[model samples]
Target: MGSSEFQSPRVIKAAGLPYFTPANNGGAALNPEDPSTPTLFRPLTIRDVTLKNRIMVAPMCTYSTNPDPSSPAIGALNDFHIAHLGHLASKGVGLVIIEATAVQPNGRISPNDSGLWQEGTDSEQFKGLQRVVNFIHSQGAKAGIQLGHAGRKASAVAPWLSWEGKKGSIRADESVGGWPSNVVGPAGGEEQKWAPGNVKYWAPRELSTSEVEEIVQAFARSAKLAVQAGVDVIEIHGAHGYLVHQFLSPVTNHRTDKYGGSFKNRIRIVQEITATIRAVIPDGTPLFLRISATEWLEGNPVAEKTGSWTMDSSTELAKLLPEFGVDFLDVSSGGNHRDQKVEPHGNYQIDLAGQLRKVIQQAGQKTLVGAVGLITEAEAAGQIVQGADEAVATEELLAGQEPKADAVLLARQFLREPEWVLTAARKLNVPISLPVQFARGLL
Candidate 1:
């Protein structure tokens, strides 16, 4: 295969033509008049990693592991993960990030979440993940993993199981190999059930200061394990009401210790985790941090009184992340507070990403931003990923406007269409790499 515009020499290269070909390659590069290519199909480089396109598959927990605690195979990857992630990579996605994996057993959102903390590279967790990462690399797509601790939301039943009959935050108690007694967070009590009534979530125990430090180490440890598994990137899952976000939001972190109170205190855990992970991973490896950006608690009477994690807070933190060695900020929102009022609609979080992107650009920071949420359809994605000059040259629109994000991430959309990149290339009238075996199908 010829050199890929998106491929970095540092990471492993797959044989055959690049899976997600760039329009700038020889065929299109020869035509100076051919400028119809969309930015969504363009490559994005962060540190040593370069993606073939701006479409990233957002981390979505599959909860496909064995639920039985007594089973040694619990919290390990298997055939399902390979088929799940491999199918996406083969279809031309530039980056395929694995789901929210736990840093420790107790940190899993469900009893079936994949986990790190195994002894060595020879461990089942390491071998399983390596197999999955190898497949992603073989398909010419960069692979990433989100290391997270579910915190107060731990030990819940999978969404599908809950939808069948149970509702709310249903727990997977001891009867099902889950440790309900171990459910913990920044502040502990019955009042902090996430959902107040009829929810199966147990009252969480507040993590002691020492326990908090240990969790930070767990993130770093998990990152080290990921590096060994040949993952191209490591993302700290600080978003959605997880452990790190639990500390970031004042609504949940009522701790009187050094970890709570002021903004600096509240952000301590995330800062520490970032520093530690950077210390462990190779310098060339990019570290991406996913953030809620906002808890969506604006204008609520309860939020007004108790204070909430708002856009202002996110902006303040975004500026400091680059200094902590974060190369990219994956902007997402909500899932922190129950009273958080959000009217989900088209481009609901795009504006927030745009606001945050402007702030980052104004500050002259190097951190790249990614927008994720209801971003379906190829044309809309192309516009969001650095607006097309020809498509938006009119004065009626924000003429010469910068894009809302450097890239657009999708969860449900990718789940619906694994070949989204190929479909997008076709829609935009651009050429992309197709699997050699599947070339006949396209013809």
Candidate 2:
């Protein structure tokens, strides 16, 4: 325990690119111009913020926030978040997006989910997020947060609660600090419950057209707060069977009002949310939207009768996002319906991203695309960013094989390997920087 047994501490400068918007002294890459470098390691500039690399840590909820009835800090990030995200940033991840944080209390998927509902920069929610953002910045990685509303999916038990033999939505009326009766969806009814035959979920109430507008405002308000917290990027959670996804999918959205019916009407809420967030946040800050490209209801008889959300629908929406002030599209799929039949394989979601990218390229939009889902391998990640696959045989898509996506987002993989970026660089045989304290471990 003597001082002689300890090594001298060295100051670690931020490790990032020089072109970052509102530039800082973050460290630059050792060799950005090396043609042999993998595309995953290249820098990408979206609006004013420039990411040092394409490897992004996708937002995966830890469900570690304090949701106790006696605690005023419920839904605020804490020490666990700081250590978790900070550790990843320090290891050289380009961006670390916080979990799907609820914009309003009722929007939370579980009582324990993170939230940004409280107002003012002085609030615990704001202060906690600001602390996390500061650490992410100090480590030279851009911080991002996914703002979402779970809708009918709200008030559910955390998956880990399975150890207690609990499953699905909480129907015990605030027994665990959840509001089972207040759960709302695009359509209301017992028949519309998420899981067709499960008695665990409460029957949802249909949100009034006016209430839908309020939810849109909540999204904008939360986005404004995120900007205040110094988030470099904001992604609207429009995918994964959340509130927005409920409205997007015809199977779930059965409203007769302006917020429902035809394609334009169904997407109306998303359009408003995107434009509102853009208006509230600084123009320099980039906005991203995550969407379920398809409901994967290809042969379902119910889907055939009701019509389903498909890649074609997503393509149309993707083309309009650039015009709606969205800077990026994070493509994911299959969480809206129980009938969604999908057998996921490696890079299963990248193909949908490719379809959207092609449309964006043909239209000459500058919007970037990010692919997610089952992308766990370093070489496959490299090929996606590099467009290493063969060209498409379709004549309309013959404008050279565009990269499958501009970036790759991995969620679970990063949890399993906090230093994934470092490991990936080693695997690809490319040189990368390590923190001076850990430099001795570099082989």
Candidate 3:
């Protein structure tokens, strides 16, 4: 992926921290009228969306525990989600992804996750989401939602809580009265039970074809809700061993039907779901997806052999998704299985992303792409964007402090510091610095 190298900008100090001198290739570069001057600070536009800068806030669950309104924080749903998302808006990220929300009550990873399942779910449970989007718009940032369904992994204990919970416990096919699969359809009438998990993650009852269709409809319903909630983008979560991931992985989906045998079939559900949602969302509002390029462990349902959602799969998916109207690809891996093969460095999965871009670019595909692993240093992030062998779409790198990617996306960083974009702008010495109202309180 090495070809063009960025002209490193001279670093300067502003507000007591080192800042990058805006360059032709700096985070925000504008094209020069003169041929001799390189383009610098150009506005980034995706579909009908244009961002002031490439920086974005990645979706993250604070595990705020707003599950029961009758509980201590029962009525705090709107307040919690609004404050959580509003903080990112205040920070000035170009894009802010609200946490992964479930499309159905049973699809949620935990009872606490934000959702848009029913008609009133958003109106009541997520009035906060709209307020957050309004806040982001006020700050010139586009708001997106990461819609997800935890399949076999559903109904499990949250990390913060004790590992033992009766609510999320599932049942296996062999244990006692057999697995009672609970899906929207009534195919598995014999056993009306939940899925079972041998390990910590839940192993949901294998869904029937009819049930899968119901799940697909649920996603479409959620998309309509998102549109009603005023979201600017809709990102489907097909990664990290969720319901869609379960169907995509060979280990999890052993079905002998059209949705299982081949890589294309396994990914059919996710692909169709994307298309279904895309059809309903406002035209031109960019559609993006996050996928676990590979699952980590053995016997794990999400693992791949060679043809499935690997880098090759990603490239193919990237190329094909655009036909259905997707705008970008968020690359991630290792949730299908627990024991994944990884280098554990700053840019290990970068090769996967870069390789995917190479394939897509070589094929002359027009889909935008992004990376979201250990991207911390600005220089390294810039290198990937500059040197991508193919027409590499856009690069998105995220790290702890959140400024290393072509466009940084962060979860923990935003949770810790909602105004991180402001911090980044000041740290990088951008002209559109944080509003003066926050200047006094920033320090």
The top-ranked prediction according to lDDT is 2
Alpha-carbon lDDT of model 2? 0.83
Clash tally, candidates in order: 0, 0, 18
Q: Which stretches of candidate 2 lie over 4 Å from their true place?
A: 1-28, 163-172, 197-199, 387-401
Q: Which stretches of candidate 3 lie over 4 Å from their true place?
A: 1-42, 69-77, 120-122, 163-199, 296-309, 386-406, 426-429, 440-443
* Higher-scoring candidate on TM-score, 2 or 3: 2
Model 3, residue 297: distance off in Å is 5.5
TM accuracy, model 3: 0.75
Q: 118 in model 3: Cα distance from truth in Å?
A: 1.4
Error of 2 at 67 (Å): 1.2
Q: What is the per-residue lDDT of model 3 for residues 1-443, given as tens digits with 9 covering 90 to 100?
A: 53224333232211211332121112222332222211111245677887666656778865454665244332223656656775566566667888888786666665566767656543564565666566555554678898888665555445455335534433322232122243322112222113323534333455778778877888888887776777888889988767787677665667777777787888788778977887787787888888876554543333434333455566666678767677777778876544565656777666666666666666777666676776554445445444222222233222212221234465665656665555554444444444333545754
CA-lDDT, candidates in order:
0.82, 0.83, 0.59
lDDT of 1 by residue, 1-443 (tens): 66555465333344432343321211111122344456667667788998877788999999898777767677889989999998888777888899999998999999889888676888778888888888777777889999999999999887788888857558888877788889999999987778775567777899999999999999999999999889999999999998899999988899999999999999999899999999999999999999998998888876787788989999999999888999888999999878788898778898888888889989988688888999888888877875523343333235656788888889999888877777877787777756544556763
lDDT of 3 at 387: 24
